[model samples]
Target: MTPSTTHAQHPVGSGFTPASTVDDVLEGIDLTGKNVIITGGHSGLGLVATRALAKAGARVTIGSRDTDRAEQAVSGIGDVEVRQLDLLQPDSIDAFVARYLDSGRPLHILINNAGFPGLGGIVRDARGYEAQFAANHLGHFQLTLGLYPALRAAGGARVVTTTSGAQRVSDILWDDPHFTTGRYDPGLAYPQSKTANVLFTVELDRRWAADGIRAYAPHPGIVPATAFNRSVGEEAQRAMGLIDASGEPVIDPDRGKKTPEQGAATIVFAATSPLLADIGGVYLNNSDISPLDEDPRPVDLTDPDTEVPVDVVPHSIDPRSARRLWELSERLIKSPSA
Candidate 1:
């Protein structure tokens, strides 16, 4: 299980398929007394996962930028609460972590589910870092580090980060992650951040596995109903076959388009599955570990017939790059202008 050896990238044949819903993966699992925190748990797949986890008896806490909206969204969902967390703001992330830790509760699961697609144009946080990279990767990095004590206190914890199939398309733009030097492309920025998510998982597992805390990155298949896809605009979505001529969502699990429930299956599976009790640092898709696919073919979004490659690529799972990313993230979060 050395870092260079694929990090157990092969599938374990979990007996689940792309069509499996959240309920399917959580069939007999009981999460009594478990304390979980999910970012962006008020909407889209996050909302679906929050309801399902709460139904399974886990006390779920949601981190959202708007507490009022979050509370309203989770209304009637038992054993769930919401707190303010703006991932693009470093102070906000720290404050959220502090509030949770002060409660003296052990964190059984942490889902880094919130993300920014960087759809229309370039947006930067106060630190001038790219918004997608800042929020999706660095913000979660800080929160996880802040919650280290609570995770260790739980004795065994799992951290699941919601990545995307887009990770296959790009690695880190090592020279200029924030688009400081080159022309900004939203397409490249989003994929770079998603790739960071998987690399972060790989490095986190390597550093924390001995502490009884394991990490996973789940590529919840494309769900057109999510705000992520909606931000792409209806015309573009239809062009990509995510929606039909009449604008209804295209539901094809085998081809990666899925309902919200189906999209969340792998997320909760990574969080609670006993099947992965011995595995960590791998990318998951369709409710199972994804096999390594190193093919260099570029993704084609315009062709509806071409299937997007979502498997783990070498750049996203490379041990050396993972370690380097960990160090780079540490530096970026510490510096005021980074």
Candidate 2:
């Protein structure tokens, strides 16, 4: 089957607004027997999404690098199970996939929501790929492909990757993806990974629609509570105007931050909405399909006045680039680390 297409991105009048909660998106929908795997469900938006889905009757598994932390986090957040997955390690991803496949369960939903906080410097994986790209893009790429059998067995499935408005600011940095000759900046690496998320959805949808798999990339909105700034440093936050000169977080009403429930709403919407049954590979925000970029200008990540652009950048959804990214990811996954 050819990939389903929608002409433009506008509010579908999803009846759920930017302020809608996860409960709002899930209203009247019963996932009773469905099975879902949410990576990074230990905290932030992923943890909350797990809670909502589990409460709605889906069998939820929280895949994390720290299984103990994940298990403890979700111990009271409905009946969520836990699995081990370190997205930074290919072996860890393989082990996680193998365990899931061994269970003989169909994967109704796969949420690739785990990500690295900006470390403000370059970190490389064993394979010499940029760590952010490896964890946020390549790891999920390998995991999704490894779980293909489970996804196919379900007969129909939805894959939702948590992309960001940051995607609008960057491209793949294809010529020097690992920054060998180019200057290394985690700020650049971070958005580049987000761009990969968008392209991955586009290419995955094109290749797997016939197999009954549909993919979505949703921006969970400006979720400060779930952000990695604390781990990165106050200077980075201060630089972004997220913190004041006194080292206090700036609460700018113009930069509205979503509550955890509100943050998870778009993810739930993308995964379960009947509104999107016929749509695949569309980027979403505020629980609505996002408009394609009419203006493709890149946003500067370091500018205090600059906000993360929510619209899909033109290059992010470019078919040719998406295909190239998919191939690039495959090679990176297969490379032998010296």
Candidate 3:
């Protein structure tokens, strides 16, 4: 896994096919003695992800904004440690790190899995920043850097950030990030945040690869019936055709769309798959490296180019853009800690 060593661009064939569930991906992979942390591991895809990793014998720590929810979710999910953490609050991030540090456990994996979609209306943090951008991008940025030491200590841990196809909508609006001058648009805001996710991974992988800290950002495909979709109301759901006339979601909770187990497969793959031992800074779907221009347009709406033709979507994995985005994000977040 030398930083300069590059593997062929061909897709890494996964044993667990497209229809594979999280458990399928981790069937015989024993993760005993490994310490893993997953943000937003209490609900939706996060919960499913936690279950898979934990079942594989990994010591999982579920970090959440809500302590009660975290406790409830982890209660029967194998041997899991629940810690109260809010990516939005720097102090909470600091506290979570301190507690983990005090425990003297070497962190082996970090999955930045939480995200928010700006749907209902324009919401801002107390700092007057748009909530989606702050929560989805800034929050995880802060948390990752804060936990860098633990990741470094493990020497070869992987950092998997949850990215979305929505990234095609827009890159960060650097000059008007807060939407101060123009009207606030939820649609644009969500896509912008997702784009940041991809760029963040690109930058992080570029810089950290030298130190054995490879980063991956993955498009976990669509979750039309999870907490991730809860933010979008009836109108947005209808527009996406995810809901029915009665206001009930058209997709079944368990079998329809991707089940939570299936939704978490790629995330699990990206985090622990040996297939990616030499892969860094790439965008993945269904455990395979994807084409950089499959979609052509940043947010192309015309039939999406299904490069691999699976539930997972394709994405750009440009190294140069990743480097540039990394620099820009460092400047923007500008945390003294980073």
TM-score per candidate, in order? 0.97, 0.90, 0.85
List, residue by residue over 1-338, the lDDT tens digit for candidate 1: 44346468889999999999999999999999999999999999999999999999999999999999999999999899999999999999999999999999999999999998787779999999999999999999999999999999999999999999888778999999999999998888999999999999999999999999999999999999898898889988988888999999999999999999999999999999999999998899999999988565776666768888788888899888899999999999999554
Per-residue alpha-carbon lDDT of candidate 3 for residues 100-142, written as tens digits (9 for 90 to 100): 8888787889999987766677887655678888788877887
Clash-forming residue pairs, model 1: none
What's the distance in Å from true for residue 247, model 1? Answer: 1.0
Report the Cα lDDT for residue 221, model 3: 68
Comparing candidate 1 with candidate 2, which one achieves the higher TM-score? 1
TM-score sort, best first: 1, 2, 3
Worst 10 residues of 3 by lDDT: 304-313
Candidate-wise lDDT, in order: 0.93, 0.84, 0.74
**lDDT for each residue of candidate 2 in 293-315, tens digit (9 for 90 to 100):** 75766557666667656777577
Residue 246 alpha-carbon offset, candidate 3, angstroms? 6.9
